[model samples]
Target: MPTDVTYPILNAQRATELLEIAKSYDNDTAFPAAELKEIGVLLSQVIGDDKFVGSAEDVAPTADLLNAFMLLLICQEPTSPAAAQSALHIASLGALAGNPAITSRGFRLASRYYDALQDSEKAWAYAKKAAQAGDDAQLIKLQNIAEQKRAAEEALAAQQAQAAEAEETAELEPEEPEERERTGTLEEQLNELRDRLEIAKRENVKEHSEEFVDINRQVQLAAFSEEDSLPASPVGVAPNPSTALAKALSILLESAVGALWACPSFATRSHVANKSNEILRKYHLSPEYATLPAGMLARFYADAAGNNTDTTGETAADFYGLAAKEYSRSGNEARELEMLLRKVEVFLIDNDRDEAHDILASRYVNALKYTELPIAARWTVLFSETLRTEAENMFKSTQVLMDFLGRHPIASARSPLDFNALAEVFELLGDRYTSANDAVTAREKYRVAYELFNTANNQEALAALAKKA
Candidate 1:
C-alpha cells in the first residue's frame, strides 16, 4: 500500500514504542534532549492531523509521555531560555490531553521566565494561573510581591505629601514672634522640671541599690552557712542536731524534711533566730541539747524566722537530700530501697551521676538484706536488676526514644500510645537484626512493630518504618 504520505502520522504502534522509550529515558540524566524534543515534535505533528484522531483517544497516556519528554528536554537545557519556553508550550499542550500537573508546571515555567525578564505584569499573570492550577505557594509569593510594590508606592506618595505640608508649615511658622517666645518659656520650664526629676531618681536608685546589695550579701552568707552546717544523712534519715542548727541559721534554707520538702526564706530565718534567742532568754539553755536532734523545735524556729514568707529557696540537691532521708526512715527495707532508687533517678536528672551511682550502690547492697520479704523482696530484686541493666546499656536506646519524641512532639500528642518511642526502639532493633542477617525474623518483627506504630496514628513514622521493613 503506497499510501498518501503528505504528513508523517505516528500510528498506534509507533506511538506506543515512542511512549515506552520516553518513559524509560524520562528520569535518565544520560538521555539526550534532542531525542526527547524530536519525539515531542513528532507527537505534536501527529496530534495536529486527523489521521491519528482515533489513536489520540488514548490521550492521557500520550500526554504523560509528552510531559515526560518535555521535562527531560527542560532538564537537559535548563539554562536555555528558548528550550524553557518550548518545554512550557509543550506542557500546556499536554495539559489539554489530561495532565493537570503538566499544566501547572507550564504556568510555573512561564512565570519564572517572565520574572527573569523583569516583566512584572506577565510574571504576575502566569503566577496567578499557576496558583489556579494548584500551585498555592507560588501564588502566595506573587501576591506578596504585588503587595510590597503597592505599599512602596503608597509610602512614596505619603512622603511627598508630608514634605509639601512641612514646606507650607515652614512658610507660615515665622509669623508669630510673641507666641514663639511663650512656647520657648514653657519648654524651658519643662526642662527644669525634668532635671529635678532626674536628680530625685538618681538618689532613689542609689538608696535602693545599697539595700539590694545588703540583701544579696545576706542571702549568700545564709546559703554558705546552710551548705557547710548540714551533715550528710543516708537516704531516709532525719536531719541530725548540727544540720538542724545550720538550717536554722540560713534565712534561705528550707527544710528538706518539711511537708513540701523545700527551704525557708531569708525573712523566716531572721524571725526564727529571734524566737530561739527569746526562748534562750526565758530559761537556761543547755549546751548538751545543742547536739541533740532538735526535732519539731528546729522547724518551729525556722517557721518563726520565715515570718510566713512565700519564697521557698529549695535547690535540686536539697530535694534529693530530703528524698534520701525519707527513704532511709521507712520501716520496710524493700520499699525504702525503691524510694532510694527514685532518689537515684532524680540525681541522674540533675546530672549528678556520681551521686546517682552512690545511691544505686547503697540501695543494691541494702536490697539484698530484704530477701525474706515476699512480694516486696521480689520487686526489690527486679528493680535492682533493671537499674543495673539500664546502667550497663548506658540507657542509649531509651535516650534515642526520648530524642525522637522531642523532635516529633505532635506525633506523641496525637497518639494514645507513644508511637515515636516505640518506633525508635523498633528502629534500633531492626538495625541490630539486619546486622545479624536475620532478615526473615527482622522483616516480620519490623512489620508487626510498624503496624503497631501505624495504629498509633503516626503516618510519617508508619511510612518510614514501612520503607525500612
Candidate 2:
C-alpha cells in the first residue's frame, strides 16, 4: 500500500496558473497532444509521489491540475477508461484535502463518465455528491441528461415491442413521423414535483438520508422556482411568501452557524450565535420553518455548553428540550428522541447523574411502551449503558440490564443488541458484583460475559476476562 508523504507547498503563481487551466476549459476545448502529455507527466509525478500534505490550500492546486489533465484526456479520447480513473483519483485527493470545489469537479466528471457507461444509479450518486459539495447546477444538468437517456431507452423499447403495429399504422396513415416529446411543459413539471413532494410528505419519509433522494432533489429544484409559478410548499403545508425567501433563509441560517464554527474567539461565536438566534426567532413560529430553526438553536447551545466555563449545562438542556418539543410538533419522533438523548448526554457530561438518569429513564420507558421495538431497542440499550456507567445505584443498573435481557434475549438470533456491547455490559456487571464482594454472582456473571466475548470472537476481551477469573 502506498503511504502519503508531506511535500513543500506549491508556488502561488504556479497554483493560480494550474487552477486557471482547470476551470477555464470544457470537454469541447482541445489541448495540444504535447501539452496534454506534459500535464499527464506532471500529474503522474504528484500522484506517484503520494505527497498529499494535510493542507488543502497546498494540495488544491495539484488536484486542479490532475482534474485538468482528466478533462484534456477525455476531450482527446472520450472512450478512454483512463480518463474516468483519473477523475476518480482526483476525487479521492479532494476528499483527503477537504476541498469541496475539487471534490465537486471530480464528482461531476465521474458522473458524466458513468452516465456514458449506462450506469445510471452510480452516475446519479456521483451527481448527488457533487450537489452536496455545493454544485447544484451540475446536479440539475446531470438529472436532465439522465432523464433524457431514460426517455430514449424507453422510446427504443417501445419501438421494438410495437414494430408490427407501427408498420401497419404507417401504411394506413402514410403520414410524416412526429418528433418524440422530450419533457413536459413548465406547469406540468411543477405539478409533477408538487405531487411527488406531497406523496413524500404523506408517507412521512426520512429526508435526512439517501433513502429518499427525490425529496432532497425536489427541495433543491424548488429552490430555483421562478416567482410567477412557485411550487414552494408541499401538500397541506403553509407556503412561504415565495420559494426564494425560504431558500435564502435556509442559506443564511446555515452560513451563520458555519461562521460560528469557524470563529476562534468565544465572543465572536456568541455574537454570531445571537445574530443567528434573532433570524431563527423571526421564523421559528412559522409551521413550515419551526423544526429547522429549533434544531439549529439546539446545536448552537450545545456548542456553547461544550466551550463555556460554566459546566452546569442548564442552558444547553433548555435549548435541547425546546428542540425536542419542536420535533414532536413536526411529528418527528426520531429527532425528538435524538434531542432527548442529547439532553441526557449534556447532563451526563456535567456529572449530574440523577438528572441524566431521571430524564433518560422517563423518556425511555414511555418510548419503549409506544415506539416499535426495533426503533426503541437501540435507545434503550444506550440509555441503560449510560446509567450503568454513571448512575449512583448499581442495583438499578443491574435491574435495567436484566430488564433488557428479559425483553431482548441475547441468545436469540432475532435480537438487535450487539454481542460485543452485551459482553462489555456483562463484564461491567461482573466487576460491580466483584467490588461488592458477591463471589457467587460475580463468578456467574463472569462466566456469562466470557461466553458472550467468545461468541463475539473478541479474543482480547476473552483473554482479559480469563485473566481476571
Candidate 3:
C-alpha cells in the first residue's frame, strides 16, 4: 500500500520533533492514517536501503527514534490491522538492517499481532523471538508449545507410516486367509493418512506461507553495515555511563571499541578511553574490582584496537605497556601477547610497520620456545597488517611474514588460533599483491587461503576472480 516518494530527509532536531509528535499521537490527536502510513514506509525505506546515514550526529538517534515511533504506534492501537502491518514492517526493517534492539521490540509486538490473527505457528515464532530477547514467561510458554508441537508432529508421522506398512502387509497376505473381512481397507487408510498430511502441512504455514514482504531492493542499498557498526551519541559530548566501571565497559563494548574509534570527534574518543582507564585503575585500587580487558578474545586475533588515546598525546603503546606489566605480574601470557600486539599496532598506526614487524618476528620465535607445537601463526597476521608493498627496503620483513605463516600451524580447524584471523591474513596478502598488480602472486595467496578453509562456502571462487589492478 506504500509508494515510492522522496520527502525531504529530516535532521536530528526534526526527527526528535517527529518522535514527540508520534509519542503524543492518540485517537483524539490522531496523526492522519495517511501521514502515519507514509512515515512507516519511509522508515523502512531509509533504514532498509541503508540510505539513512548522514553527517549530522542525529543520524543514528533518528533511526532509533523511527523504530521507537512504530513501537509506540503498535502500543496505542494494539488491535488495528494497520498497526499490525506497521509492526511487521518494523520487524522486517530490523531483520534486514540487523538491529538487535529493534528486532527484539518488533518481535514483541509481532507476537501479539499473530496471536490476534489466530495464527498459532507464527504467534509462537514471534513469541520465541521475544523470549530470546529476555521474556521469561514467553520462554516457558514457548518451550511447552514446542514440546506439544513436536510430539503432535511425531505422532502424526508415525500414524502415516503405520498405515503405509499395513497397506504393504495386506498385499502380501494371500487374500487375508480366505474371505477374511478387511479392517480399514488400504485405500481408506491411505486417504486417512493423506488427510493428516494436509493438516500437518497447514500447521506448517509459518515456515511455508505464501505471504511475504520483499526487502531485497532495500538490502542492496545497504552496501556496508556502517550505520549498525558506528552508532553516534548526540551532537556534543556523549555522557559518561552512569553504571559501575565494569558495567560501563560492557556497555561500551556493546557499541564496540571499533565503533568508538570511528566517532566523529577525537576529543569524545579521548574522553571515553580516558574515563574507562580511570575506572579500571580505580577498581584495581579497590578491594573488590573488575577488569575491562578480560575476555578469551576467540582464538588468535589479538586485540590490536586502535589507541584512540592518540588525541590526548599519550599513545596506546603506553596503555599496552601498563597492561602488559599488569598481565605479566599475574603471569597471564596470552593477555601479555595481546597487550604486546597493541604495542605493535601503535607502530603500524604511526606508519612505522617495519619496526613492529621485525620485533614481532623475534617474539614469534620466542613464543615457539614455550609452545608444545611450533605454532607462531597468529603473529603472522599482526605482521601482515603493516606491510606496504609500495615502500622500499621492506622486502626482508615481508619475506619473514610469508615464511612464518607458510609453515602453517598443524593445529586443527578448531585450534586456539583463530582460523578466520589466519584466513583474513591470507586475504589481506592477496589484496596487497593485487594492489601491486601481481595477479599471479595474488591468486597464489588466495589459493593458500582456500586450502586452509576448504568448505563449500569457502571464498575460493571469489578469490580466484581477482583481476589485475
**Ranking of models by lDDT:** 2, 3, 1
Question: Tens digit of lDDT per residue, candidate 1, span 369-388?
Answer: 55222222232323333443
lDDT of candidate 3 over 1-469, digit per residue (tens): 1223244344556556656666667667645465456556546545544344322333344454554466466656655665655556545555545566556666766776677667778877887776465442443344446556766886679657655644554454321112223246333433443343345345543332111001111111121123412222333433333223333333333222332323343333334345444534434433223333444211111222332423321355666656666665566776676666666665444465566666565576655344322134456555555444323434653665566556544253464234554555565576566555565777687676665545324454333322111
> Could you tell me the lDDT of residue 65 within candidate 3?
54
Candidate 2 total steric clashes: 0
Write the candidate numbers in order of decreasing TM-score: 2, 1, 3
Q: Which pairs of residues have clashing backbones in candidate 2?
A: none
Q: State model 2's lDDT.
A: 0.58
Per-candidate RMSD, Å:
21.2, 26.8, 32.4
What's the distance in Å from true for residue 193, model 3?
A: 70
Off by over 4 Å in 1: 1-30, 37-41, 47-62, 94-102, 108-128, 134-216, 222-230, 239-250, 253-469
Q: TM-score of each candidate?
A: 0.31, 0.35, 0.30
lDDT of 1 at 387: 42
Top-scoring candidate (TM-score): 2
Q: What is the clash count for each candidate, in the order shown?
A: 16, 0, 1
Q: Highest lDDT: which candidate?
A: 2
Model 2, 177-211: lDDT tens per residue?
A: 23233256544544554455455445534331221
